[model samples]
Target: ASPQSGYTLAVLNVGAPAAGMNAAVRSTVRIGLIHGHRMLAVHDGFEGLAYGKVRPPGIKGGETPQEVEGTPRCRGHPPRGIFHPPRTLPKKYFEEISTNISNFGIHGLIIIGGFEAFTGSLELMEGRAKYEELCIPLCVIPATVSNNVPGSDFSIGADTALNTITTTCDRIKQSAAGTKRRVFIIETMGGFCGYLATMAGLAAGADAAYIYEEHFNIHDLQ
Candidate 1:
């Protein structure tokens, strides 16, 4: 390997953040370490990596891995200076991210997110041949309430959002039940997907719910 940077299994999410992200990160790190692989936390998705665009310098100090505040961080490393935002930079300004996975002995990558995540996974899998000298396997984890990712029927954040919506609806029902014959017309979230509204309605035993998937009518309750 590339003189052993003392790390293994680089991971990051390129899509929007979800509620289960930190939890997934925790599990991924603890498990990878237990399995004898050191972990590197690539913050801010591919953008964080865009900075790594420049050929990564030779693996330096801290061959010994250590933990700080329940999270492992490299010691004796100076903080990075200010740089341009990820989006604002032109192709000319972008640094060339080092592509030396085999040298680092990285065996696999774990990606977490929704639809965007799926696309990123495909990109990595497709570029396996040209991107690195060694082939790296990839695992994609779904983490969103939208539950719209292909090939998977469910996602991590769906349950969390379901619980929250159910509880809130229950509270609203309790507080406003006192008003007799008062038809409560509560507006719910979930722009294109109606899973949230449908589940909240079922969990809360709501008298009615207007979801986007199935035709909903206001006159039904009457």
Candidate 2:
């Protein structure tokens, strides 16, 4: 018997924040919706998935109160509720998330994050298989300052971190006096490749920059 075709897949981004995190989410949602797939966003990191922090639109509302103290008499509006994800994610949160997805019939997942976060995705994939339930397709999007993920020229947050470093270095150079000898070491997040470190160092006129891609001999400085 031929297998029945499943519904179009939805994406779930499970990772840390980069400058373009929201942009990626928006794009994914738009594309998925265009293709007739239901879009769902997973809050926080993998912990969000594990603890069942999955939310849909209209689930919560805004923080500001609808009625103001000094408000004038205009048209009356309904009170809007505030949206909040689950608090106190526990170590075994993934188990809970997996159970929830299984029960709720979730079919697709998209994970976005650094190397550590990818590990969580792997775990979730394995969980999906072990339960003998419907298998969900998982996609991973790299988003780390380290730029260590192979096969990709750019990660999500690298550009933003690089810009911040350049600005800070420029300020330091302007404040230095001719008579004063100043040494500054600016450390940014790059677990492996050091792409952000190298770019920022060069743009900021750093004398030397060290990265995982190329080795730096400490004895040369001596």
Candidate 3:
């Protein structure tokens, strides 16, 4: 569509912060702009959307896509408890978000973050029947170190997290090898999924790694 008749698209970051989030947001905004759409960003995720915290892409006045993409951390994230699974939020919450969508003239939404991002998109999709403003198209981009989002083999930040863990573990092993016999129990974050710990164990040559997905006992550890 022509720029004059282009749709308005907004992007939101939900759930916990993760590496590579800024790059994802930058790509979304740039892609939308390239397609002649009016691209806006919703700060603070759904809470921001409910409160009309919509604005043009950068956080600072002089920021550009190049700066945004080069950043190492996420720009922002919704606070915990601000979002729940689909159909679990109160009716008024949906109403407030819908009001902001109408006010912003948003035609589509792109959510970037972890599992919460997925659930938030689902909630918006299911709310379409009750709120016309929510009928707009939605997209979810997985951007968590956890790598726990279902159906996605890999999340945006998972690789970076794994590499960091492997490097650190290598350093730790080197140190241990030079000293008296000692053992270390390392923990990696992956929410309920064991992907990080499991994969990192294989990559780092850990004696054993545990994840929430698997059940174990004292004998198993022994």
Candidate 4:
């Protein structure tokens, strides 16, 4: 069935947390609500849905998604994460998450994260038969420091995380400069994408980077 009016949507994080995850969650929630959809924040990535409940660490619960701020507003420091512990649901609710289409009136899911999010969304999309009575719309926003998600070159936190890597490298480089013949090998997280390592190396003026995009060659560094 097609999605009807006022469809309830759930927002999920699919992988490792990064700088702008909270912002994405906040934005999706606010905008989804403005579009007349009911929004439910699914905490702790897929685990939350699998486990049925999670503690919303820094997030305030009682506030509806419509009330969330869509605009970027800095309130001192942004929250590190939105997960804590102890928010419980009925046992074996993961089964319900997969099959109970109309249980919470959830007909839409907006996932934010990297390849994991993309893959998971596809599985859910493929499993549409499980919820034959509802039109479950699934969308994913790439959000990883890896920036490895195929559709977009720039993921949600990629830019910010790259900047951080460069900034940290700059500080470390400064320290390395004070010492004689000391080279610092800074590591970054990008699995196989290497976007972070390549860009951060360039941004920080590093001598070279061992990235997956190119063959490993010590001569390249030389």
Candidate 5:
């Protein structure tokens, strides 16, 4: 179901930030708000949740100057910035979060990360029964550079990685042309799947592209 179906969705990003982290957070928040549910952020991933680093925004009372209409007591006052202490998760952070899910009135969660991130997600999902008793749902969105997620065309970072590689390759091609270089060998990360390398090569107009998805013969390029 879409986020705007009146479900309180919490987004827990378990890995390092990338180009689209903020976008994902913003989108999730916007949709959740539209759906008529309060949104909470779990910072620093499972570590944050485990350590009780969840933060929710709310108004705190601040001193304001008043203006007097007919008397001094009626005078207007300027507003001042309010301070709110960060709420650290409880000592039994995970257990507390699970039990208090109903108390806090949360509806769902969106987890974003790579394969390793699934470990925490799986933990949460496996514990869904306990959470569901309190009315909480969990969802996951894969967003790693590995592009190893099954049955998906691309992860969140795939496009950015491809663009970076293509730009770098363009610069290298210019230098190669200037220096009269005959060959250029570019190695990229991705142990079992070379989606990034292949896409970048094709987009950057490489002489040939090598990917783990297909067999390569050295003599074919020679």
Candidate 6:
């Protein structure tokens, strides 16, 4: 497909920093490019979207760079920006975001982040009724250590985190066994979801695991 025959799409990262964010963006950009779409990488998340801080990836200062080259293939620190509660931002900001989208001629958006990405996409979907510019295609890719995003069994960076925790737990258990310790408590990161802790505990062979989904009292712990 010719460049002129392709859609103008944007990809951005939102919410807290997470592993595998750059890889997601690279895949999005590469796939879009292969399909001959014009891909713009927006920095700083939604704030960048509102302010129009975007440029074609791999373009230094070209008048019109055609393709994004040398996209990062490793884990990247995701930008933590542009995350607000649904319908909490001032109306004027939404207007600006819509206006910027139109100005940039972005026909679609690919948001890569955690639960906040899901909420952000829904917020934009809700705005479609009021702002036609926001009616464009939206895609959210889950990439958080929390693994809290619904509709998916696992998120991008979750497995990596789970492995790290499991391995660390093994080492701690070995040290404790050598010292003749009876009990040890390990913690993992998952804001409201218990996926990480539960999975790590099982993998590390812990006697018990506590999570947000299951309420536990002092008696339960005992």
Best candidate according to TM-score = 6
Q: Residue-wise lDDT of candidate 6 within 1-222, one digit each (tens)? A: 435545898888777756677667777877777677888877667776776777777644542334444232112423333232121222446798999898889999988888888888888888888999898889989988999988877788898899999889988988898776366777788989899989998999989999999998878775
lDDT of 5 by residue, 63-89 (tens): 111210110000121222211112222
Candidate 1's residue-wise lDDT over 81-173, tens digit each?
211111221122122333434444556667667666677666655554555532566777887777777889888778888888888888888
Off by over 4 Å in 1: 1-7, 53-105, 128-135, 180-182, 187-191, 215-222
In candidate 1 the C-alpha lDDT for residue 68 amounts to 14
Candidate number with the higher TM-score (1 or 4): 4
On a 0 to 100 scale, what is the lDDT of residue 164 in model 3?
98
Worst 10 residues of 6 by lDDT: 81-90
Which candidate achieves the best lDDT against the true structure?
A: 3
Given candidate 1, what's the lDDT at residue 2? Answer: 23
Reference-based lDDT, each prediction = 0.57, 0.57, 0.76, 0.65, 0.58, 0.75
> All candidates' TM-scores?
0.67, 0.69, 0.83, 0.75, 0.67, 0.84
Tell me the spans in candidate 4 whose CA falls farther than 4 Å from its real position: 1-5, 50-66, 69-95, 129-135, 215-222
User: Which pairs of residues collide in candidate 6?
Assistant: none
Which residues of candidate 3, in runs, are more than 4 Å off? 59-92
Query: What are the clashing pairs of model 2?
Result: 12-110, 50-93, 61-81, 61-82, 61-83, 146-190
Q: After superposition, how far is residue 29 of candidate 4 from its true place, in Å?
A: 1.4
Please give the clash total of every predicted structure, in order. 4, 6, 0, 2, 11, 0
Sorting all predicted structures by lDDT, with the top scorer first, yields: 3, 6, 4, 5, 1, 2
Scored by lDDT, model 4 comes in at 0.65
Greater lDDT among 2 and 6 belongs to 6
Candidates 2 and 5 compared by TM-score, better number: 2
